[model samples]
Target: MMSSTFLVMRERVVAAIMSNPVVGPDSAGTLARMNDPSQNCTFEELGFDSLARMEFCIFLETEFGISLSSGEIEASPSINAMAAYLAGEG
Candidate 1:
Protein backbone atom coordinates (compact mmCIF):
# COMPACT_ATOMS: atom_id res chain seq x y z
CA MET A 1 0.00 0.00 0.00
CA MET A 2 1.22 3.49 -0.85
CA SER A 3 1.17 6.36 1.60
CA SER A 4 -0.83 9.51 0.88
CA THR A 5 2.29 11.65 0.79
CA PHE A 6 3.89 9.45 -1.85
CA LEU A 7 0.70 9.41 -3.90
CA VAL A 8 0.50 13.20 -3.77
CA MET A 9 4.12 13.52 -4.77
CA ARG A 10 3.60 11.14 -7.69
CA GLU A 11 0.67 13.18 -8.96
CA ARG A 12 2.72 16.34 -8.61
CA VAL A 13 5.57 14.84 -10.58
CA VAL A 14 3.21 13.80 -13.37
CA ALA A 15 1.64 17.25 -13.35
CA ALA A 16 5.05 18.85 -13.61
CA ILE A 17 5.92 16.59 -16.54
CA MET A 18 2.75 17.58 -18.32
CA SER A 19 3.17 21.26 -17.62
CA ASN A 20 6.73 21.50 -18.78
CA PRO A 21 6.84 23.35 -22.12
CA VAL A 22 9.75 21.20 -23.11
CA VAL A 23 7.56 18.11 -22.81
CA GLY A 24 4.92 20.08 -24.74
CA PRO A 25 1.20 19.66 -24.24
CA ASP A 26 0.92 18.08 -27.70
CA SER A 27 2.50 14.81 -26.63
CA ALA A 28 -0.83 13.45 -25.54
CA GLY A 29 0.14 9.81 -26.02
CA THR A 30 3.17 10.06 -23.82
CA LEU A 31 1.19 12.13 -21.36
CA ALA A 32 -1.44 9.43 -21.08
CA ARG A 33 1.19 6.81 -20.43
CA MET A 34 2.64 9.04 -17.74
CA ASN A 35 -0.72 9.49 -16.08
CA ASP A 36 -1.14 5.76 -15.66
CA PRO A 37 0.44 4.84 -12.35
CA SER A 38 1.06 1.27 -13.50
CA GLN A 39 3.43 2.38 -16.22
CA ASN A 40 7.07 3.06 -15.56
CA CYS A 41 8.07 5.55 -18.22
CA THR A 42 11.59 6.83 -18.40
CA PHE A 43 12.46 10.37 -19.41
CA GLU A 44 14.24 9.04 -22.45
CA GLU A 45 11.11 7.19 -23.57
CA LEU A 46 9.20 10.45 -23.32
CA GLY A 47 11.66 12.05 -25.74
CA PHE A 48 13.22 14.28 -23.12
CA ASP A 49 16.24 15.73 -24.84
CA SER A 50 19.12 17.24 -22.98
CA LEU A 51 17.50 20.66 -22.91
CA ALA A 52 14.20 19.25 -21.69
CA ARG A 53 16.02 17.29 -19.00
CA MET A 54 17.61 20.49 -17.69
CA GLU A 55 14.30 22.32 -17.82
CA PHE A 56 12.62 19.49 -15.88
CA CYS A 57 15.31 19.62 -13.21
CA ILE A 58 14.84 23.38 -12.89
CA PHE A 59 11.08 22.99 -12.63
CA LEU A 60 11.42 20.35 -9.92
CA GLU A 61 13.86 22.44 -7.90
CA THR A 62 11.58 25.47 -8.08
CA GLU A 63 8.31 23.60 -7.53
CA PHE A 64 9.49 21.42 -4.63
CA GLY A 65 11.93 23.91 -3.12
CA ILE A 66 14.68 21.33 -3.07
CA SER A 67 18.08 21.35 -4.68
CA LEU A 68 18.42 18.55 -7.28
CA SER A 69 21.18 17.77 -9.66
CA SER A 70 20.91 16.05 -13.04
CA GLY A 71 22.77 13.16 -11.52
CA GLU A 72 20.16 12.72 -8.82
CA ILE A 73 17.32 12.95 -11.33
CA GLU A 74 19.10 10.43 -13.52
CA ALA A 75 19.39 8.13 -10.57
CA SER A 76 15.61 8.29 -10.16
CA PRO A 77 14.62 7.99 -13.88
CA SER A 78 10.88 7.37 -13.54
CA ILE A 79 7.79 9.08 -12.13
CA ASN A 80 7.45 6.69 -9.21
CA ALA A 81 11.14 6.80 -8.43
CA MET A 82 11.28 10.58 -8.55
CA ALA A 83 8.19 10.91 -6.39
CA ALA A 84 9.45 8.44 -3.81
CA TYR A 85 12.81 10.25 -3.60
CA LEU A 86 11.18 13.67 -3.40
CA ALA A 87 8.71 12.54 -0.76
CA GLY A 88 11.68 11.86 1.46
CA GLU A 89 13.38 15.13 0.55
CA GLY A 90 10.19 17.09 1.08
Candidate 2:
Protein backbone atom coordinates (compact mmCIF):
# COMPACT_ATOMS: atom_id res chain seq x y z
CA MET A 1 0.00 0.00 0.00
CA MET A 2 1.11 3.57 -0.63
CA SER A 3 1.27 6.23 2.02
CA SER A 4 -1.12 9.18 1.86
CA THR A 5 1.82 11.52 1.56
CA PHE A 6 3.15 9.57 -1.42
CA LEU A 7 -0.27 9.57 -3.02
CA VAL A 8 -0.56 13.34 -2.60
CA MET A 9 2.91 13.85 -4.05
CA ARG A 10 2.03 11.64 -6.99
CA GLU A 11 -1.08 13.72 -7.69
CA ARG A 12 0.95 16.92 -7.58
CA VAL A 13 3.52 15.46 -9.97
CA VAL A 14 0.78 14.39 -12.38
CA ALA A 15 -0.82 17.83 -12.19
CA ALA A 16 2.53 19.41 -13.04
CA ILE A 17 2.91 17.09 -16.02
CA MET A 18 -0.61 17.85 -17.21
CA SER A 19 -0.03 21.57 -16.90
CA ASN A 20 2.92 21.54 -19.27
CA PRO A 21 2.10 22.96 -22.72
CA VAL A 22 4.26 20.27 -24.24
CA VAL A 23 2.17 17.64 -22.53
CA GLY A 24 -1.17 19.31 -23.07
CA PRO A 25 -4.43 17.58 -24.06
CA ASP A 26 -2.82 15.22 -26.54
CA SER A 27 -0.93 13.47 -23.76
CA ALA A 28 -4.04 12.64 -21.81
CA GLY A 29 -3.62 8.97 -22.50
CA THR A 30 -0.02 9.07 -21.33
CA LEU A 31 -1.14 10.93 -18.22
CA ALA A 32 -3.70 8.22 -17.57
CA ARG A 33 -0.98 5.61 -17.86
CA MET A 34 1.07 7.57 -15.35
CA ASN A 35 -1.73 7.38 -12.79
CA ASP A 36 -1.32 3.66 -12.61
CA PRO A 37 0.53 2.63 -9.45
CA SER A 38 1.35 -0.76 -10.86
CA GLN A 39 3.40 0.73 -13.66
CA ASN A 40 6.76 2.45 -13.45
CA CYS A 41 6.41 5.21 -15.99
CA THR A 42 9.59 7.07 -16.86
CA PHE A 43 9.88 10.52 -18.41
CA GLU A 44 10.94 9.04 -21.73
CA GLU A 45 8.08 6.57 -21.69
CA LEU A 46 5.72 9.50 -21.14
CA GLY A 47 7.23 11.37 -24.10
CA PHE A 48 9.22 13.85 -22.02
CA ASP A 49 12.34 14.62 -23.96
CA SER A 50 15.20 16.76 -22.68
CA LEU A 51 13.23 19.99 -22.79
CA ALA A 52 10.20 18.45 -21.16
CA ARG A 53 12.39 17.06 -18.37
CA MET A 54 13.78 20.51 -17.77
CA GLU A 55 10.27 21.90 -17.67
CA PHE A 56 9.23 19.22 -15.26
CA CYS A 57 12.20 19.98 -13.03
CA ILE A 58 11.20 23.62 -13.00
CA PHE A 59 7.64 22.70 -12.16
CA LEU A 60 8.70 20.56 -9.23
CA GLU A 61 10.98 23.27 -7.89
CA THR A 62 8.25 25.89 -8.18
CA GLU A 63 5.36 23.83 -6.87
CA PHE A 64 7.15 21.79 -4.23
CA GLY A 65 9.70 24.42 -3.27
CA ILE A 66 12.44 21.87 -3.69
CA SER A 67 15.55 22.01 -5.79
CA LEU A 68 16.40 19.14 -8.06
CA SER A 69 19.44 18.93 -10.25
CA SER A 70 19.13 17.46 -13.71
CA GLY A 71 21.06 14.49 -12.41
CA GLU A 72 18.58 14.02 -9.60
CA ILE A 73 15.69 14.15 -12.02
CA GLU A 74 17.44 11.69 -14.25
CA ALA A 75 18.17 9.47 -11.30
CA SER A 76 14.52 9.43 -10.38
CA PRO A 77 12.67 9.47 -13.65
CA SER A 78 9.47 7.78 -12.61
CA ILE A 79 6.59 9.56 -10.83
CA ASN A 80 6.71 7.01 -8.04
CA ALA A 81 10.42 7.56 -7.63
CA MET A 82 9.94 11.33 -7.54
CA ALA A 83 7.19 10.93 -4.96
CA ALA A 84 9.47 8.78 -2.88
CA TYR A 85 12.20 11.38 -3.17
CA LEU A 86 9.80 14.04 -1.94
CA ALA A 87 8.76 11.86 0.94
CA GLY A 88 12.38 11.42 1.90
CA GLU A 89 13.02 15.13 1.64
CA GLY A 90 10.07 15.83 3.89
Candidate 3:
Protein backbone atom coordinates (compact mmCIF):
# COMPACT_ATOMS: atom_id res chain seq x y z
CA MET A 1 0.00 0.00 0.00
CA MET A 2 1.10 3.55 -0.62
CA SER A 3 1.79 5.73 2.41
CA SER A 4 -0.21 8.87 2.92
CA THR A 5 2.99 10.89 2.97
CA PHE A 6 3.97 9.53 -0.44
CA LEU A 7 0.51 10.15 -1.81
CA VAL A 8 0.61 13.75 -0.60
CA MET A 9 4.06 14.16 -2.09
CA ARG A 10 2.73 12.90 -5.42
CA GLU A 11 -0.04 15.47 -5.30
CA ARG A 12 2.47 18.19 -4.53
CA VAL A 13 4.62 17.08 -7.47
CA VAL A 14 1.63 17.26 -9.79
CA ALA A 15 0.78 20.69 -8.44
CA ALA A 16 4.32 21.87 -9.00
CA ILE A 17 4.26 20.61 -12.58
CA MET A 18 0.99 22.45 -13.18
CA SER A 19 2.45 25.70 -11.90
CA ASN A 20 5.65 25.49 -13.94
CA PRO A 21 5.42 28.18 -16.61
CA VAL A 22 7.78 26.56 -19.05
CA VAL A 23 5.90 23.29 -19.42
CA GLY A 24 2.63 23.69 -17.51
CA PRO A 25 0.03 25.08 -19.88
CA ASP A 26 1.09 22.81 -22.71
CA SER A 27 0.88 19.68 -20.62
CA ALA A 28 -2.10 20.27 -18.39
CA GLY A 29 -3.61 16.96 -19.44
CA THR A 30 -0.43 15.10 -18.63
CA LEU A 31 -0.31 16.81 -15.25
CA ALA A 32 -3.87 15.73 -14.61
CA ARG A 33 -3.00 12.14 -15.59
CA MET A 34 -0.21 12.22 -13.01
CA ASN A 35 -2.84 12.27 -10.28
CA ASP A 36 -3.54 8.65 -11.08
CA PRO A 37 -1.25 6.43 -9.04
CA SER A 38 -1.10 3.87 -11.81
CA GLN A 39 0.28 6.33 -14.31
CA ASN A 40 4.01 6.21 -15.02
CA CYS A 41 4.44 8.53 -17.96
CA THR A 42 7.85 9.96 -18.70
CA PHE A 43 8.72 13.69 -18.72
CA GLU A 44 9.31 13.58 -22.46
CA GLU A 45 5.80 12.32 -23.09
CA LEU A 46 4.55 15.22 -20.97
CA GLY A 47 6.45 17.71 -23.18
CA PHE A 48 9.48 18.17 -20.93
CA ASP A 49 12.94 18.23 -22.38
CA SER A 50 16.31 18.29 -20.64
CA LEU A 51 16.07 21.99 -19.80
CA ALA A 52 12.56 21.65 -18.50
CA ARG A 53 13.62 18.61 -16.49
CA MET A 54 16.43 20.62 -14.92
CA GLU A 55 14.05 23.47 -14.18
CA PHE A 56 11.65 21.02 -12.57
CA CYS A 57 14.44 19.59 -10.46
CA ILE A 58 15.24 23.09 -9.31
CA PHE A 59 11.61 23.68 -8.52
CA LEU A 60 11.38 20.48 -6.49
CA GLU A 61 14.57 21.27 -4.64
CA THR A 62 13.32 24.74 -3.75
CA GLU A 63 9.82 23.55 -2.86
CA PHE A 64 11.07 20.68 -0.67
CA GLY A 65 14.26 22.30 0.55
CA ILE A 66 16.20 19.27 -0.62
CA SER A 67 19.05 18.95 -3.07
CA LEU A 68 18.78 16.41 -5.84
CA SER A 69 21.59 14.78 -7.73
CA SER A 70 21.26 14.49 -11.50
CA GLY A 71 21.11 10.72 -11.10
CA GLU A 72 18.26 11.05 -8.66
CA ILE A 73 16.41 13.32 -11.01
CA GLU A 74 16.93 10.94 -13.89
CA ALA A 75 15.91 7.96 -11.87
CA SER A 76 12.66 9.54 -10.84
CA PRO A 77 11.27 10.81 -14.09
CA SER A 78 7.59 10.44 -13.35
CA ILE A 79 5.29 11.88 -10.71
CA ASN A 80 4.99 8.60 -8.79
CA ALA A 81 8.71 7.98 -9.12
CA MET A 82 9.51 11.48 -7.87
CA ALA A 83 7.15 11.05 -4.94
CA ALA A 84 8.83 7.78 -4.06
CA TYR A 85 12.25 9.38 -4.33
CA LEU A 86 11.19 12.26 -2.10
CA ALA A 87 9.68 9.86 0.39
CA GLY A 88 12.99 7.97 0.58
CA GLU A 89 11.62 4.93 -1.17
CA GLY A 90 13.53 5.38 -4.41
| Candidate closest to the true structure, highest lDDT | 1
lDDT of each: 0.75, 0.73, 0.73
lDDT of 1 by residue, 27-75 (tens): 6676777777766577767667767778787777788776777787788
Candidate 3 ranges with C-alpha deviation above 4 Å: 25-29
lDDT of 3 by residue, 1-90 (tens): 999888888877776677666776345566557768766656656777667776777777788776776567678887788888888777
Best by TM-score: 1
* Candidate 2 residue pairs in clash (backbone atoms < 3 Å): none
Q: Report the C-alpha displacement of residue 31, candidate 2, in angstroms.
A: 2.8
| Candidate 1 local Cα displacement, residue 79, angstroms | 0.9
TM-score: model 2 vs. ground truth: 0.77
Clashing pairs in 3: none
lDDT digits (tens) for residues 3-90 of candidate 2: 8888888887777777766753356576567777655567667677777777877887888886777677778787889877877743
Please state the error at residue 19 of candidate 2 in Å.
1.4
Per-prediction TM-score, please?
0.78, 0.77, 0.77
Model 2 poorest 10 in a row by lDDT = 23-32
